[model samples]
Target: MGIVINQSIKNTIITYIGFAIGALNTLFMYVQFLGDTYYGLVGYILSAANIMMPLMAFGVHNTLVKFYNEFETEKQKSQFLTFILFLPFILIIPFSLIGYFGYHQIASLLSKKNFIVYDYVWQIPVIALCMGYFEIFYAWVKVHLQSVFGNFIKEVFLRILITISLLAVYYNFITPIQFVFALMGIYLTMTIIMKLYALRVKMPSFQLVIPKNVKAIIWYCIFIILSGSVANLLLEIDKFMLNFYIKIENIAYYSVAIFIATVIAVPSRAMHQITYPITAKLMSENKHDDLNNLYKKTSITLQIIGGLIFIGIILNIHELYKIMPADYSEGIFVVFVIGLSKYFDLILGNNNAIIFNSKYFSAVLILGLLLIGVTISLNIVFIPKFGIKGAAFATLISITLYSLSKLLFVVFKMKLYPFTIATLKSFALLIVTFVLFYFWDFGFNPVLNIVLKSILITAFYLGLSYYLKLSSDINYIINSVFKKIRN
Candidate 1:
């Protein structure tokens, strides 16, 4: 818990800073500087790349985390690390060849509905390659329990660069087209930096020495690819599908809503950076009791924090939208729908870490494959009728169902549930605060209204959470802060 709390706090702060920069880009600079069409194009390109990222990396990122601790000796560990580093090239080479040979056909298919997407279609694979390797390197560091630097690079560095590039656009230093290319360059640069940092943490042996469990490792990586693809598809497929179903600019609209809803998941994302590797280590050591304790603690802590974010977003969303371009306001419903789904996900805490690191990971692969099918089918059916709102509905429904399935699997297979009496209490507190705050708003400027409401909501939520002792870890941290203040 010490290591988890220490790094998670740092990761959470870094992630928030990243999201703040992203908010500026998504809500203001993107709309104001790039305009909606190019914004949508950029959004589509990135989303499509994310969907392809798992396949491109061939699941090496997750494989590294799950298997890194199995070896006891430095020689074995270095062999494993060396293997993980190069394993992706097996898929990368063939994928690159396919992309090279099928460029026009691939471009044509993606841009059929919106032709602007065709020219930038090449960037999808390029960015996906960068993203795939970035995660692999990120996992390289995470397994060593050194996640802060990697988390900062993952969360903050790229967004800051994007801020600079957006400013570059604003100052007429770069065209919108150049901005698109600059994004690809940014991802590449991030990956290179991550690789260097990963090596500093533990350099992989250049000589290829296969571990005894190479067969099992390869099998795990294969299953991980399916699971990773399913997860990424669930998150990014909506934007990809929307490109075909709606006008390109509408992707920008949906992206704004998605971004707003996504802020709720930042705590989960930040905490997972540390919890994931720790969960893997616990499983490797067969420490079921510690693992379960961690499960409950992380679940409650993320729920409390994520609930506050959910409430703030839903409550202040309209006021926030008031300051944005009128066209972007239609995504308010998208915000609520996706925000609720993400909140549900957050409460599950380290459920993903538990399942992915467990032996029954193969079982989840079947469920994940089914989930991807359901997600895509729903998108095809819904996006045409309701547009971006339909995309939101599809995502909300898909994530809710998928989350329930994973929860049930864990409960049945591992006898571990993330919920407790505190969970219910925390959930009730969230509802009460939302209901109480929902109808009220200051007549001040939208930004001022948002800031005021957020402060009040934070005070109300955290005060109640502390009083109820919903999470001992959270309460302890609050008391520590109070003690420091008194001293």
Candidate 2:
């Protein structure tokens, strides 16, 4: 818990600061500087790259973390690291060859719905390759329990750079075409920096000697690739489908809505960086009790935080949209559906780490792939009927259903549930706070109104959470901050 809380706190601050930069970029910079069409293009490009990322990395990122500590000998661990590093090339080579031959074919098909996408289609695989190595290096550090720098690079570095780039874009320093290519440069640069940091954390021995457990590791990587791809697809494919179903600019509308909602995931992302390796280590030692305790604490703590974020987003969603362009205001439903789905994902805590690191991980491949199928099908059926909102609905349904399945699987087989009495109470508090403040408009300028409402919401919500002691962890942290203030 000490390591989890310590790192998660730093990670949360970093992630939110990144989000602030990103919000500036997303809400103001992108909309004003890049405009809707190019913004949607950026959204589509990154979403497509994210979908391709798990494939290009071939799950080495996850495999490294989950299995790194299982080996007893330092020599053996080095060999294992060396093995996974090269294993991705097995998939990367063939995928690259295929893309080389079929690049135009892909561009043609993608262009069928939106020809604007055709010329930029090649950047997807390029960024995906960059992303693959980035995660691989990131996992390298996480297994060493040094996630702060990686999280900073992951969350903060790129957004700050993008902020600068958007400034450049605004001043006509680069064309949109160059801006798109420059994003690939940004991802590649981040990956290179992370690779250096990962090396400093643990200089790889780089032995050609494969670990004795090569078969098991390879087998795990296979399932991981599928499961990881499933997860990425769930998060990313909505934007891609929008490229198919509606005008590309609609993807920008969807992006803004998704960005507001995705903020709820900050705590979960922060927590998972430390939890993944920890969960893996705990499972290896067969520490079921500690694992379950961590599971519940994670659930309650995240629910408290996520509930706050959910309340903030949903309640202020209307006001938030008021500051955006008029066309963007139509995505209020998109924000609700996707934001609630992400909050549901937040309450999941470390369920993914538990399942992915468990022996039943292979079984999860079936479940994840099943959900992917359902996601695509839902998108196919619904997008034409509902436009970008339809895409959001598809994602909401897919993620909610996928989360339920994972929760049930973990509870039934592992007898671990993340919910408790406090969980239900926190949820109830969230609802009451939302209902109370949502209709209580400030009736002033949107900016001032948002400020007053947010401050009031924060005070009211945190006061109640503190009064109920929904999470001793959060309460202790709050008290510590107050003590520091007094000092």
Candidate 3:
């Protein structure tokens, strides 16, 4: 648990740093330099690539992580790595070709405005392939218990590159189209770097051994593909649907709010990165008690951290939006809606990982697919009437239901419920923080008020946490930092 907390702290810092850069770029630079249309295009391209990523990688990223521990020998591990690396190429080439030949048709289907959509079509496959391979290589490293570096690369490196690209556009060094191309190139470069780094640690030899359990590996990979695609769809289908049903420019507005809201999930991502392989190992050894404790601690800790972020965003969203362009202010409701959904996710903690690694993973995927259908249906019905806000509502409902379904499955089937007294206490703290911060008025200057109120609100939250002893992990971290400073 200490190690998980330590890694999560490191990853959380890196993620926030990257997020700060992203906030600058998305709120100020991109919105100011690139018009809404171009900004939306960037959002669409990335979302589309993410939606396509699972298929592009053919689920090898997750499969590698799950199967890595099963192999006993270094040679066997190397062969497994080699298999995952080469396996994606089989899908990549054909997928790229399909994307190439079907590019215009896909573009036409996506948008009615047809404003330079084809210009960036070529980048989609490239971005998808890069994202796919990056996940694969990152997983390869994660299996070796080397996650912080990958976290840095994922949470910091890519955003830093995007920040640079946005700066180039702001300086008029590159046109919006060129910036899109540059973004594609940056993803490819990052993938190559991840691959090289993984190789440096353990050169993935191309030797294929006739494993007795190769059939099981293949089956696992197939399951991963289905499960991964359904999961990605749950996360990303809304943006893709927006591109279809609404104006492409609206994506930028929605994306800005979604980014702010998604920050609440950062701690969960960090914890999951370190805890997932651990969960797999525990499950494999039938260590149910250890797994249950991990699940409980992860849930409570993430809820604590994610609750703080959600409160920060919700309480200060008005001031935060003051920095953005005027048109984006309408996204305030989206932020709240999506923030709640992400909060639900955080409350569930490592439930998804537990389900994915469990024997009932296929049922989980089937349920996920059902939720995807509900999400799309809700979007279809609500988006026409409510626009971006409607999309946010649909997301909130879908994800809340998704979280509940996973929790129920884990409890009913696996008898794992990650709830404790701390969970209730954290929820109480969240409500109190929101109430205290919500009605307080600090003055006319949104920025100044936000800054002052945020400081006050954060201090109050921490003070309350100390009074209640809400989080030993957080207390330990603070005490450790103080001890180091005193020394």
Shift in Å, residue 294, candidate 3: 0.6
Candidate 3, residues 35-65, lDDT tens digits: the string is 8998889888898889888888988888888
Quote the lDDT for 128 in model 1. 96
Runs off by more than 4 Å, candidate 3: none
**Candidate 1, after superposition: displacement of residue 482 in Å?**
1.2
Q: Give lDDT: candidate 2, residue 226.
A: 86
Off by over 4 Å in 1: none
Q: Which stretches of candidate 2 lie over 4 Å from their true place?
A: none
In order, candidate lDDTs are: 0.91, 0.90, 0.85
Pairs with backbone N, CA or C atoms under 3 Å apart (clashes), candidate 1: none
The better candidate by TM-score, 1 or 3, is: 1
lDDT of 1 at 166: 91
Clashing pairs in 3: none
Taking every candidate in turn, the Cα RMSD to the unseen true structure, in Å, is 1.0, 1.0, 1.5
Clashes in predicted model 3: 0
